[model samples]
Target: MFKSVLVANRGEIACRVFRTARRMGIRTIAVYSEADARALHVREADEAVLIGPAAARESYLDGAKVLAAAKATGAEAIHPGYGFLSENAEFAEAVTAAGLVWIGPPPAAIRAMGLKDAAKTLMIAAGVPVTPGYLGEDQSEATLTAEAARIGYPVLIKAVAGGGGKGMKRVDKPEDFAAGLASAQREGQSSFGDPRVLIERYITRPRHIEVQVFGDKHGTVVHLYERDCSLQRRHQKVIEEAPAPGMDAATRTAVTDAAIKAARAVNYEGAGTIEFIADASDGLKADRIWFMEMNTRLQVEHPVTEEVTGVDLVEWQFRVAAGEPMPLKQDEITLTGWAMEARLYAEDPANGFLPSIGKLEHFVMPDGIRVDTGVDQGGEVSQFYDPMIAKLIVHAETRQEAAEALAEAASHVQVWPVKTNAAFVMQCLEHPRFVAGDVDTGFIAAEGSDLAAEPLSEMGIEDAAHRLRHFAARSGDSADSPWHSLTGAVGFRANAPTRITQAVVVDGEAHVARMLDDDDHPMTRLIGLSVTRVIAFENGSAFDVSAFARGGSGAGNPASDGSLRAPMPGKIVATPAKAGDTVTKGQPIVVLEAMKMEHALVAPFDGVVGEVGVSVGDQVVDGAVLATVAVPDAR
Candidate 1:
């Protein structure tokens, strides 16, 4: 085993690898950008090195800086954890050429599977079933459109060099194909520096299933069953589970055998995943499953596979890098129980899932489950990296039990100030369709609005009001309290339920709440941000409210004003509307790129663009006004 290993990544995956390395008595090293100076992963490492600036291109993506850190720290091996330079073939070759171990597949294997079109070709040649698609090298738009016509409508336009849903789009008809192709190509160029794409027939009801395969340097490869990742939003997986719920023995055998063949074809080593797209219009059948793509490194949802198989994937990576044989043969590996993992991201489900960036004032993950996180209380979610804060993993004896346990755990997540998708995850876990194992790739898109419905009920308002009163009274003097003066401070029965009218502000809207002066309210979780403000947590969501002041109507800022502001700190990518341009409400005026996603700032009302404050490529902070519109004067 290597004496020391440096993780060429940041955030949760970095922390996850370090945990395993330490457990195996290996010294762990961490590299971080300036933004992650106080990050949890940095503090947990045996040795730390500063790589570069906060921006990923300047820091995490700088292969030279990472190699220098490993060299300076005398790191015997380098572990590229899941992202950044993990799948960069050049970096892998550089690590090996530097006389250091690379805890990943060989550069040749990475290059073989790096491009989707090339990988599909290789798989087809190797007799591995591949999805039918157009992989020709013609970069002309006309050629792509024709291929789409040949392939049929409702096809998927995927970047040949894309993963994680970037640079991928689905077109339902010819009218939408042009826009989808342009968007996919743009994202592909921006994300992977490749503007090429492939057209594939879209599966009506697709289920994403992938098998975890591990190969050692001695040419031993084994399979660890399959994981169902159908719960997705915007093509990004939200929840994943091992030992797919409805998979039978025959179907499992076929997928696993194909996965082994694909791995052997590439001479793959270390942890790799062979993803298959299944047409679930019918049940999971062998002939309907086709190769979608292969992830050349560890995956974000590998914890689910580990929970079920009782295997340490990171440990396997280390052993394989040391030229050791496979730890367990294919037949020795057993799936003990069901396991599920939910990705907890710092995003607002109510606001189109835009990344929420800020300090975590009251961050707390629920107990009694495995939580892999890189941020803690007081740490900020930076805009330069992925917004995922933690992953909640649960294992149970049955699939139903696993889903229920995970849902209950999600409901206990308590994050404040920085919004989270905890409530949204809980809703997905508890949905009837999800519970019945009747989900597909489009599940979230079809049910997102209902899943993110307004969570504050009447009972929540009343509970918040009563809590606000008690908090206000406690902050004030007991001898002379204005809240007590309102209630006369004279209650004959101490435990009796007394009715009182209390004024409270929920989300800046003032309300007079009639509450029983008892502690039996349904929503009891409350935290005081200030004397006048309190946050009530219900159903895995935080409701920020305040006590309504006397003679003061707590009205929030009007929403009809046509001010287009950046929702978070980011760089302006596009300004579609210029000054004096006539625009309608919900028109995309400015697009801000932050946290690796683009957000369109829309016009609040129909009006003429009065001013354009920022141009494309300008960086702006949260709430920075980018443009404004003036209503046409009615004469």
Candidate 2:
């Protein structure tokens, strides 16, 4: 085993790798950009180095800087933790050439699977069934249009070099093919610097199931079962589980065998994943599955596979990179209990799932489950990186138990100031369809509105009112106040008898409650309290209620002022409306890009544009006004 290793990544994956390296008695080095200087991973490393500025291109994505840091720290190996440089073939080769062990698959294997079109060709030759598509080298739009027609309607135009659903689009008809292709190509060039694309037959009810494959330098390859990643939003996985809920013995054998074959085809080394898209319109079957793509590095959802198989995948990566043989053969590997993982991101589900960036005022994960995260209380969720806060994994004797436990764990999460999808994730896990294991890529889209609804029930409103009365009563009296003994009393007077009412806002809806004399209200339990916000966990969900004394100031509702503000900190990429322009409701006025996702600020009502506060390419913080609209006068 290597004595010292450097993790060439950031966020939770870096911290994850560091944990394993520490347990194995290997010294770990961490590299960080300016944005991550105070990050948890940096504080946890044995030795740390500052690479460059916050922009990924200047730091995390720069191979030379990473190599220099590794060499300067005397690291014997470099682990490309998943995202930035993990799948970069050139970086892998450079590391190897620098006399440092590359703790990943060989550069040749990465190159083979780097491009989707070429990987499909390789998989087909290796007898791994592939989807019907056009992988031709032709780059003409005319050619792509003809191929889509040949493949019938509802074809998918995907960038050959894309991942994370960045450069892909589904066209339902010929009329939309041109626009879809153009958009896909533009995103491809912006994200991957490659404008080339491939056309494939779109599976209407597809289920994403991927097999975890590991190969050693001794030419031994084995499979670690599979993970069902069908729960997705915007083509990105939200929840994943091991030992797919509906997979049978025969289908399992066939898919795992094909995944191993694909690994052997590339002479793969270390850890890799072979992803397959199943035509689940007829349910999972051996022949209905086809190869979608192969990720040439450790996956984000590897924890699910690890929990089921009792394997240390990262430790195996270290051993394999050190030229060791496989730790366990295919026959010895077995799946035990079921496991599921939910990715908690700092995003607002109520606002089109827009990425949120701010300080974590109160970051607390539930106990009795595994949580892999890089941020702690008071940590900053910066705008320069992915907004994923953590990955919550749960294991149990059965799938249903695991699902229930995971949902319960999600509800225990307490995040303040910055919004999160914890509620959305909890709702998904508890949804009847999801609990029954009927999931697909479109599950979130089909059931999102129902899941994201934050309706304050009558009981919820009453609870908020009770908390508000408590707060107002407490704030009214000082420590030496003579009326301090009159706590929780509605009209109890030390001076004069007066009826008091307090207003509280729950999720932007206001309600009023009369102060009661019950000092011990059994129903309202205050989990967290502050001057502005009060948090209570009720009915398996967290409710944040903002309370103020009657006629006092409350949380600002931006929509009430006819001003369109940036939802989060980001750069204004485009401002379409100018001052004095007449705009209708729901018209896109400003486009902001943050956390690598674009969000549009729309006009709230039909009015004349008043003031354009920002221009294109201006960096703005959350709640910064981009434009304002004047309310039209009634005749």
Candidate number achieving the greatest TM-score relative to the actual structure: 1
lDDT of 2 by residue, 481-561 (tens): 422321221212212112122322333332233343345333222222223433443322344433322323333455557
Write the residue-wise lDDT of candidate 1 on 20-40 in tens digits: 998899999999999999999
Candidate 1 has what TM-score?
0.89
Off by over 4 Å in 2: 457-533, 537-544, 548-564, 571-591, 600-621, 624-635
lDDT of each: 0.83, 0.82
Question: Mind sharing the TM-score for model 2?
Answer: 0.86
Residue 379 shift from truth in candidate 2, angstroms: 0.7
lDDT of 1 at 355: 89
**Candidate 2 local Cα displacement, residue 3, angstroms:** 0.5
